[model samples]
Target: MTAETAPLLELRDVGKDYGSVIALDGISTTVRAGEVTCVLGDNGAGKSTLIKILAGVHRADRGQLLLDGRPADFGSPREALDAGIATVYQDLAMIPLMAIWRNFFLGAEPTRGRGPFRRFDAARAKDVTRRELAAMGIDIRDPDQPVGTLSGGERQSVAIARAVHFGARVLILDEPTSALGVKQAGVVLRYVAQARDRGVGVVLITHNPHHAHPVGDRFLVLNRGRSLGSFPKADVSRDELTRLMAGGAELDQLAHELERPAT
Candidate 1:
């Protein structure tokens, strides 16, 4: 798609309120086809609220959600999935004990035969699972092995590949690298790039600007439930983005406080 075209997913002036508390305030961002939009924020910076709205777990209190330039509202997670929006949370939603093929087609398994003779197509599923994983640049030695046996990064790769195979137009990844070690995080980041290369609009929600900078086309910084700023990669430097995400003023204040002499 051309740059002039509307993004695959766009949130315009989105806001969320819980009683008297505003979880997100006038937040707006876009995830374009073949681009990664990294949402950077520290704890309680409204990242969760924004992801909930995007994943259809919670509807925005106000503002418009547009998919391909048309208005959209998802009443449930199923609706969102049906609309080609897939959310791969950090938890991964996989059965650790289940085999790779089983986990790959867990909820939506393909079956063969009918009339009381229906059975899971284990062979087809395994072959397809293996091929799909390989296509996504994941090298799994065995598709029948338990998911728990796979490393964190490999499991993440499987989740992403599953979403893409299921025809996801927009991928919302919630802190995919948070729980992983440095090397594992790097592995997942490569998969994120792969997803983008496949023309999927990726929404990578994380606190690490360094992780986001390499793969992101645009960065959206949130602080105290409000958007600090959103800028294209070309417009913002890595250091500036890091400082914004780290809350520069707060960090300076803390530094000053620590530097004060003891009473």
Candidate 2:
């Protein structure tokens, strides 16, 4: 892609401060359509601050957020959703007890008939939900089954499919695989690729370099509320990314400390 093809979402010199504490400083990144931009960090690496800014849960004190080459300011989560930017946190905002179809259209439901006489279109909603999930290669045994019955990876897949079906141009997924087993995490990663293949800009936030390396086109590494570096996948190897995120200096110090004789 060239500079003329602006990113679907861009954060320029973004900073977030809470009273006396600064969560991020001059952080900048971009998420392009048909690509996965992985944001890698250890705990307290300003990942939360960056996502909150993108999701409109918090506003930046400085810098600009541009969507499709236009300055964007999302006053609230709803406003962000209205702009076709959907965020799926690790928890996925799903009600496990609710049926799959119900969870699929939790906040936004389809209605039939006139305004005053409008009623939930149960049949159509369930049908659409099943079809959409199937299109994403997610085979839910039954739409009426409670969401709790689905596996962690399945739930995340449903969330991604929902976002895509709802016309989301950019999908910000916060650690979608952090809580899953190896097999389950792989499932979610496949869905991440599916979303990217469908032309949605995907922002994948994770502490696992191994998980991020395969599907990511670009990688942004953060530590102690600061960005260590950002590089295209072609420019950095997976082993290199692992070493960087693991803190090469800190690891070497620990290794030396352990090998040294007792004082």
Candidate 3:
């Protein structure tokens, strides 16, 4: 929130191109610790491109990305993870039939014993999973419960908790609240607040202003692959944020046209 506090992740005039298409142009925003920076956009508004760039799925074609006030170049998502940037995608990368602990430590599993005897520390995994989820204010009857059995919001909480536990300094959430019911969305938003409270910078991408406005400390609006602008929550109202994401005058014109009868 303060200029004294450096951004955990920063984009300066970042751009991405696909063949002849410009997915993003001169987009810039900052994700600061203890803050949720929400990226709001409609379909095809460059949100996906921006997330890919942040997640290291695609490299930016222009400008710079800074991490911890130093220039950073990430070749792949694994590299990004090594740099403490973790992405919790919409699908959440969870296996439906797997137990919560297994899904929690899917790729990065704990091991014990000699090489040939090495095995996943199942006991530690389940215990850590249970403990971490509880720390996030999540109460699960069983760590062995299949992740699919949890509600949408609870699954999100698990993903978030895992990222935080694994030392992710920056959390990139793609459309976190999109498919959830109102109450469920609120539950996830609260955990988002919890992450920020624990000093993890968050880049929350979503199309819903109501979902974003409540937890976001900064709002970035994108339209047709270009940034409208990034505003501090203090500088932008929820209604205005919603209105701008609707494309403002363009939406008004479309509404007027819809009201007119066909000739």
Error of 1 at 257 (Å): 2.3
Residue pairs of candidate 1 with colliding backbone atoms? none
Task: Please provide, for model 2 over 1-263, each residue's C-alpha lDDT reduced to its tens digit, 9 standing for 90 to 100.
Answer: 74579888998888889899989988888889899999998888899899999999999999999999899999999999999999998895689999999988878999999969998899999999999999999989999999898888999999999999999999999999999999999999999999999999999999998999999999998887777778999999998888788787987788888895978
For each candidate, the alpha-carbon lDDT, in order, equals: 0.92, 0.91, 0.93
Positional deviation of residue 204's Cα in model 3 after best superposition, in angstroms: 0.7
**Candidate 3: C-alpha lDDT:** 0.93
| Stretches of candidate 2 exceeding 4 Å from the true structure | 260-263
- Per-residue lDDT tens digits for candidate 3, residues 121-174, read 999999999999999999789999899898888888899999999999999999
Give the per-residue lDDT digits (tens) of candidate 1, residues 42-68: 999999889889999999999999999
Candidate 1 runs further than 4 Å off: 260-263
RMSD in Å for model 2: 1.5
Better of 1 and 3 by TM-score: 3
lDDT of 2 at 88: 92
* Leading candidate by lDDT: 3
